[model samples]
Target: MEGSRRRTTAPRARPAATRPTREAGGTAAALPDAGSHGPPRGARSRRGELDGAPAETPRARAAPRRAPARPRDTQPPATDGARAAERPAVPEPQPPADPEAPAVARRPSSRRGGRSTARQPRAPRRSRRERDQLMDVLHALRLRRQETCVSANTVNTVVTRLLRGLGNRESEFEGVEQLNTGSYYEHVKISAPNEFDVMFKLEVPRIQLQEYYDSGAFYLVKFKRIPRGNPFGHFLEGEILSATKMLSKFRKIIKEEVKEIKDIDVTVEEEKPGSPAVTLLIRNPEEISVDIILALESKGSWPESTREGLPIQSWLGTKVRTNLRRDPFYLVPKNAKHGKGFQGQTWRLSFSHTEKYILNNHGTEKKCCESGGVKCCRKACLKLMKYLLERLKQEFQELDAFCSYHVKTAMLHMWTQNPQDSQWEFTNLSFCFDKFLMFFIECLRTEKLDHYFIPKFNLFSRELIDKKSKEFLLKKIEYERNNRFPIFDKF
Candidate 1:
């Protein structure tokens, strides 16, 4: 036991050949012996262990010999070839999943960082021949609708005769000239163009106009100088003119005038509340409905709310914009009866004359879309939008509040944003239409379709249209876009 203790306690002497040597700096350096120890300290073997280590306990032997990770700076520099060889192979992308496979199996793993592959199958694209056939059908439909459009000659003749009859019948309407307005006058009439709007404007000079509400489109008119023999004097309440009384008298006069026309069977429709027009139905060769509006044309400055409105300077140039601003504004005898207690009679302001002028002469270039100039799809786009709205209205009665006016407003805003005539080139019709639709969707999503003339007026009001109806329309439009307009197939 004493001898075994001495053998274990004594420091094992190294042979002379394997002894440590003292360097010139007096530092002793130990030379590694190949046979004495299996390997150097911390040097890993093929099995990833320190060679020649003492037999570990079961616990120590079971545990992994975790190598102290070297700092990145201390790591050996690797060659490109080495890195390439060390890298794990990336698998080739799999082909599109089998159509017959379960949807869950067909979907690519989200862990792979790819877009969702579980989208609804896209409709097969139509062939060129098929597309042409469809276009031919559309053209035929367009022609059929065009046939129903009221002839320009007929419209002018009727308007002239009616104005003459009105002047002769009523002294108040003696000098009131007719200003043709609406989509028919704008040349963007879609579907049946049997509807016509002619404003019988009586220039009310030296009139004090006050806005009835926050909306710039409504106003209350008062006479600054009351004429002694004026027939309108009786319609005035205190200092302000009563739009309701004036409209009532105007409608009575129009009814009497319609009875005088014998050659053409003209019948006056019953008056509608809040409607500004005295509707006349002409049944001659074809049915034509004309709305004769009574308006007090004022040359006064536009309302304060309109200061920031009509941002068309960049699109129509400053000179054109300035001229439009200088044009006379009109207030028609139209009032919205909110409730029984609503007192102040409101007159809706009209910019129809200006709107018609802008539509006819809408080119950034002087001769744009004219006889010799480049043709843009602006008018065609407007017609398509109007047709679409008409069709949509037939399908969804809830969308009745959304009309062509909203589409026109959106188009106006879109034009201002993308001012260049080249942007609306006929060749880029599909792309332009898609962009317009996208903009419309954005407006619907935000629930704020602003009136073009009045930015303050939100056309998409909860009072006017249901919020869910707007969302439903949005989804429908998106589906149409995604599926390449299957709705047009039915059309």
Candidate 2:
């Protein structure tokens, strides 16, 4: 082994790049030094040397050249090597052991008092005060809105008496049961509870649905097997249920019952074209309106258009969605905008029940928004949006086509986009409300807000809202947004 060993002299000093650095933690860490790029300081350049020929040092080579003198107080401009030498070497950050863990922020260099020198951004001036004032205004508006809502006891008492009279007088309407629906029952009602949507649902046997319009919203209802002694036999026109005739008969029965209740001053309002509700104007103690919608409850499967919609797997859960879909859907006596041919035969599909359930139990977690659980500003955001729409409608009568339902649909879609409970934290009310408004404004700009249940159906289509009106509404909304919603001040 000694004979095979090659001659060896004093070992050359290990390069500074391989030297250990004493870190602030009192640990010697091996790090590549700044001078690793070239020969060590005071060493001659080996770039052109051959066979041990004499080489020139950097300072010796530059000694012949002279540069302009700067001010005495000004130091010489730093070279790349000098700058690198001054900067402490930092290792490339190692990723977290858990890939899903959030990344750690890199430490600021020690040169700038351990602070970032790239202009630390100052927080928005008066932002907290503005947000606080906005929330206070919203809370006041909500209280005022609550005051406008008609008393629940008063509504129940009047509806109970009216329905009882209808059941006793009309045998055909005996099976009709009340299904509370709409924004009022959903607990998002603003302005007044004087307006109520009560669906008079009549259970129907197995039925087939055919799309009446391309929108898949209006449908033609047909019974597979007409039951014997079906009171609706007269309301049928060539095997298809006549929504017009049935609704007219329903209106007549309700009108007769209203006359019987002389104690309460109630009068059926004149029927509006294309409206399915038989509106009742009550003027005994307060001026209140009740919209009695005639609906057909069907236990059959939902239409094919809804197959790709209701994306609630990541939000409300797939099992919850499936269970909700199993519940009966209603067919209101609502016809298309241009229902010239089949004016009285069309029925619009109503998912008011699903909407109510989703709103009432809206949360990713079971205890979310409940007592002792994390509260969210979802409902508050919705109310503010609704109130915004209401105020805008008052200013611009052209926005009559835009209703509270449009706002509700936008919010549901917003939930799917932002599913985290933390995003809707109640403490961040102003932030969440602004986010929701921006989403709604985007929908208005695109002129394409999809129906919650039917993806193919565009609620903001030209048929429902003209392009000119939408453009005008967009400007108004943007103006309100930029001005911190001055319209909300009216409330």
Candidate 3:
């Protein structure tokens, strides 16, 4: 190994594709030192003779021109020199790791003194004065409507409240009082465990209602399940459905029941700004003239008539006919004061809905109810007539059928049974010895037959009627002689 020796030298540098930039001389280019000349400046004479080539300009040294960009599908010519170059020498740029920070601090356009305040919205706040103003308007409206709707019940309540002293309820509301409406949520509003919507409703306590009616101050009272709520609030969430439901029910009632109205004149109202109401006026064609219907079903005896005493209420026909019925459908009630209670409640008679007696005339075999001097009685016919008239006024065919046809069928069925048993109960039982016949005459077959009523043959009318074959009328009014009695009716 020591004996082998070799010398190596780098290959000669080739001309670059581009020319090098000339370095600037600090002062001036010196002429080559006298004996050390390399080659003439900017001349290629001696170096060019070694290669035997002519000298070229810098522009001529660049790579030869190539074709323009081709579509990728075309093949490019292979080159061994480029493929043999293993490593890429050029470097690519890199991105910064921290991108958020700004390269330079910026001076704000507006200075501290010129800055604007931030804005925000606030909740509404009404003052005491504003609240009082609103309440005043509402209170005034309520007070104005009260006078017209002054129910006897309410009037009585006012009177009672006055007598008992309303505690501090009389004081006017102060402006400083602040109420949070949301507090009701905590106050325990509840639907009653009871199915009824009301614990009790405001109602007239004393008077009872009749179908064909009479008018006067009346008071009502009853127990019901009322909702728990703040009485002060006009409408609360829990009560909204209640008020709506109540009005719906009332409208349904108007659609169903009620009869003719001969006259309606009312200035009174039940609510402020007047919502609809259940108002009825006395439009009855028949008016009750009798003070009472004398019915005696009581264990207690009827009061003996005394000249100096108060008139005894005498209803002769009505008696307690059934056991006490809890059902609402069976019959209406009469108070114990009506008559002393018997097995059931003793029935006391009222001329309340009765108008005048429905007197039917029958042919006289000298028969009569023996109500001397024509006892003018009041009856249900007037009520029925009034109801029919109201229906006619409203032009309601449905109501007309309900009252005149359906309701009357039920009532006629009721009244036709047992009837009043009027004679024996009212008069002495001994007085019924005279044939027990009610004299009925003049039955009208047509609604237009008011001008002419054909006579009905009662025992009395049978004798009075002389039915001859000719001309079909009585020749002379005949008489079955109970002729001994004075003919007071003849006049």
Candidate 4:
């Protein structure tokens, strides 16, 4: 076994190329001779040999010498085709230029589709003193308008009498309650002090409401049981209550009544298509415009779609939200133009009464903003926002589609987020105003502002407001916010 192990462990001879050559000093060199031809067959070159083989011919020896090894930082730029091809194509580094030298403006790059633009520098924000002065001016303007405008008492008396007379003449409208709704009633009226919205709601019992669209705002109402001598019965096409027929009858009655009352100068405006209001121009010392809307007050359960919304639960408390939801909802004679056939006659649901209640009693605490209580800027902020929207609309005719209602809805949503009355302290009016403007800008950017009452209804409907107008309004809002609203300067 020992002899067999010795035979198997014997050392093999090294390749001729790998065998170390003895020099004059008996030093061993593993490399083959550089001047020699290719190594003999069956022999391999040593580790240090070029290409693991000796230079075979004169041409091989004369091959171009390799460039000297250079530090990465000091490497010369590639110039030759072969060197350039071997390396990545990179821009040549230019010498540093004078820092103070004027920049050379190159033509727009073709790669970028020739679009090269720079935004204009925004105007500096107004100083605190300037803003304060502006606020004073705004206040003075409000007072001046109120002073010059038609007397509210006279307007109210005239509208009330007219509505009463119409109700007396038409049994259907009898016992209809008059609700002063809109910006004027909400105490958010700005420039249009004379404009008033009075809704004459007729309570309709045993009515079934079906949504006209996915938006909870509009509905097709059906009378489950038409009461004897029911005034609304004639306006119904089958079981469905026709908004068009009801509004037409209401407008005709208002026109007839306006003619009989000679005491006050009142002229009914030409009816506009899709308008729910019977607009009357009253000249009682001064001209006052009143929009009398016909609404059906329905009591019972609120719509199922509204169950998840009215996030006021957090702000106004669960009890308050429950009470609000329990309140009867009103439906106005507002129809969509895009609605086809009978669907166009659908009435829009209105929570103006709810809104008024919420706005009037907006404080987290009951006495907030009331007499002998801490003053809050909730109404003041709403007024300012409404004024801004009105002024913008007047300035840019393209923004005619935008209304104060959008701003009002935004303010309501803003209140829910910051429910405490302290957040809207009178002292923080400027800050609150700025925050509201920011919210407006955000709504414009996203274009997804939900109706405060009906979350499903998008106040910023694409059909009503086009994309171009929205973009234009966004820029205008930013401009006004950055620069102290130049639009208000005229006032």
Candidate 5:
């Protein structure tokens, strides 16, 4: 009996090699001998122990309940090396739901350990594409600029002949000399060289200027002592020279002279209200508009209003400023739209001569943007701004009040603010253009763009651009900025 009992209680031999196998729930379970068709060792032992034990209590007899094992894909990733090998292969990591999600999701890989968190790929910056497009447009504009040289020559000939004819035919216009002005003379005219401005500068001696009301831009010009048989005496009302009368006679004379140019298809456009120019429409195949301005050349000191203006001392140097101030300023026969009897006689002050000199000699260094010097992108920035305004105005007639002069004024101010030539690098066109746009946007937002020469006179006052139009224009510009300026695509 003792021998039989020993055989029954004896310990069994262990398998040569035992390997762990992952069950359905990824719970490690011991594997049986390869050839054996039996339950695992743990299960057999638990069954034999249960059979020998006394009848258990309800708590002990009842097995603990377990929730079903989750699928391998549903489980959290295993960090343990051994468990990771036993677990089913995991699929490649997936991107977050939102593709346009912020950059937080795309953190760069960690460097401390070889571990890296999943990151979504990011979108490229728009500037690269924007730069490419801008370069292409500028190239096209350059090609078109070459085409305008022919028209410019033809227009110059017609203007020279017209000036000669006017001096010969009219006694009043005998001493008038052409002072070429506007974007054309500055060499910044874009799209087409269809517009031109020529000032008929008449010498006025012993003149006095009184500021017209609070507006420093307009002036009441009078002769200190009336000259006997002065050509301008016929147009004078009292001591004040009547801008309205002078402009009227100037237009009439221009009309009569335009009639004599039978070789060129030229006709005088009727005088526009509050405009100083006697515009001539010349159609030499393509339509060309020429503005003939009558200016009274003044050899006196500049107006008191311009004392603190120009701000070019730092940019053009103190000597340059002194020289520029020494030069004579001119007054044009430009009447205010809202001017009454006294105001109607007032002439607006002009700095076209000064503007031309500044533009021609524009540079921090003497030879900036010159043939042998560092070529800056100041003119390119100005041209782009002008083109932007032109394109915007064409699409919306509401922006007609906005003009190239505003752009020029803004650019001149920018030069003063960013005096360094490095700020306007030609190769950095996109960056420079964006800076200009942002500055312009800020001016529009504040509604406080001051006239370059007359700081007291706000060009963007409520009288000039109403609140609603300014807001609408602001939105359009912002939209263009955010969307990579689709309007420039037209170029």
Candidate 6:
């Protein structure tokens, strides 16, 4: 037996590669395959207890005792039943048993039957972008200008005209008296809210003119100062009351209550809000009211001891500033209306129709009834008549009327150049000055010229400075003064 056991141990010592091939017909090969078929020792203990080697314990094998099934329909709902009755409380909900069908996910809850699902989180909100730096800068600059209030430039042309509209209306309120300080002034101040103690101090900047043709940038300027009642108050109140009347009356007369008049960008602000305290309203047209205000203040108003002319004539020559002259670009030969590109002639005809409609009508009776305020805006009226004259000149093939204006301007220039040698010679240019003046004055009287003639001609009369020329002009102007054209009244 010892020898046999030694042989068995000796065989096991050889590697399986050398001993266990089926070709060698070794029993070790059969042993290995048998071992593969059976479970390992530990695996058998786990599997066998329930399924393979060992039988189940009597306790585990014994079938569990299930309680009797309840009749669902006959049973009262948990809410209707007594607390802690037959079935403890809520029946636990069971998931359906089909594998192919999707399972409804249940949320956990402390209560026996309750379930709560979690909610999805929302995305975060984004912040808004800040305002543009340039816009903020501009706004700051404007506010600073307002705070400083060194802008006498606020009292524009129409402001002055509106004031003129108040001519003598404020005379009842005007009387010069020296008023005291703030506390003292306030103590004397009347309690009536209806009555405003008016005052206006316009520090009109000396008009700055770069050239005859440069268009400066539009300025939305404002001004402010303390109350200086008497004359200043009169001026301020006159301007505001007049301005309000001007705009309101304009809308009323024109029947254009809603027309925005867009080409005219406008804003009228008072430093002290309503009625009067250093008020300013501005409109930026190709040319604006400030220019007119300057003109009126300078050449149109009663003579000024402190200042000579309105800023209009002060900035530009009287001839250039007044609405007297025609647009040089809008020129056309007489009978030129029939040509292919005669916009000038057409423009003139347009003005002619507009003027006739405005001047001939009793009041707001013409076509374009919506624009009846056309008559009230002397500038518009003048502009219309201006074109009409051009049309009449083209229709008659006689633009010599305009030539006469050129001649008059040229004559004054020449007379100024050499005052001693200056003399009227109607023979050399038998477009005689007198005859030209005669036809020119007639043209001015045409419904087209009605609006612009008086103001323009008066300026000419006032500005003709040569003594010899003045004397000669006076002889022709014998019946008039201030170089006023005798023919203007006749026209």
TM-score against native, each model: 0.70, 0.72, 0.15, 0.72, 0.73, 0.17
lDDT (0 to 1) per candidate: 0.61, 0.66, 0.20, 0.64, 0.66, 0.22
Give the candidates in order of TM-score, highest first: 5, 2, 4, 1, 6, 3
How many residue pairs clash per model? 0, 1, 41, 0, 0, 17
Give the alpha carbon lDDT tens digit for every residue of 198-304 in model 3. 01111211222221111111111111323345232332223221232333333333222222211322111232211222323221122111000111111221112
lDDT of 1 by residue, 1-491 (tens): 01101111112232222322211111121111111122111111212111112332323222223322332112123233344344444322222322211111111122211111224333222223333433443464453444554455566666788788877764677778978889887978755557788899998768887876566667778888987886778888888888888888888877877677677777889887678899988775677788989988888788676666677776687788788889888888878446543334678777888788888988788888999998876777677666666767788877866778888887777666555675566544544455466567656765777666676767776755779988877766656655666666676
Model 6, 398-438: lDDT tens per residue? Answer: 33224222222222222221111101111111111221232
Residue-level lDDT of model 5, residues 1-491, one tens digit each, is: 01101111111122223222212112222111111222212122221122123322223222223322343212222234344455444322222222211111111122111111113122122245776776776665562645587677777877788788878875677788989999988878777778889898989888998887778898888899886888889888888889999888878877877787778888888767788898988887889899989999888888899886777766678788888888878899887556233357989989998898888888887888888998777888888888778888889987877888988987877666556565565655664565566556556766777777778878777866787777667666656765677899986
| Better candidate by TM-score, 1 or 4 | 4
lDDT, model 4: 0.64
Q: Candidate 2 vs candidate 3: which has greater TM-score?
A: 2
Error of 6 at 275 (Å): 28
Q: What pairs collide in candidate 4?
A: none
Instruction: Tell me the tens digit of each residue's lDDT in model 2 across 1-491.
Output: 11111111212233334322211111111111111222212212223331123333333222222432322112123343344454445432211122211111122233221111224322122145546766776666553544454455566666787678877764667878889998778878766666788888889878999897576898888988887987778989998998898889989988877777766677899999889999988774777788989889998788887776776766788898899888888899998777344467889989998999999888887888889998778898898888888889998998988988899988887776555565566655654565565556557756778888887788988877898888777778756765667786677
- Which one wins by lDDT: 4 or 6? 4
Score candidate 5 by lDDT: 0.66
Task: Between candidates 1 and 2, name the one with more favorable lDDT.
Answer: 2
Arrange candidates, best lDDT first: 2, 5, 4, 1, 6, 3
TM-score of model 6 relative to the true fold? 0.17
For every candidate in turn, the CA RMSD to the true structure comes to: 25.8, 19.7, 52.0, 27.2, 26.4, 45.2
lDDT head-to-head 1 vs 3, winner: 1
Q: In candidate 2, which residue pairs get closer than 3 Å at backbone N, Cα or C atoms, i.e. clash?
A: 149-193
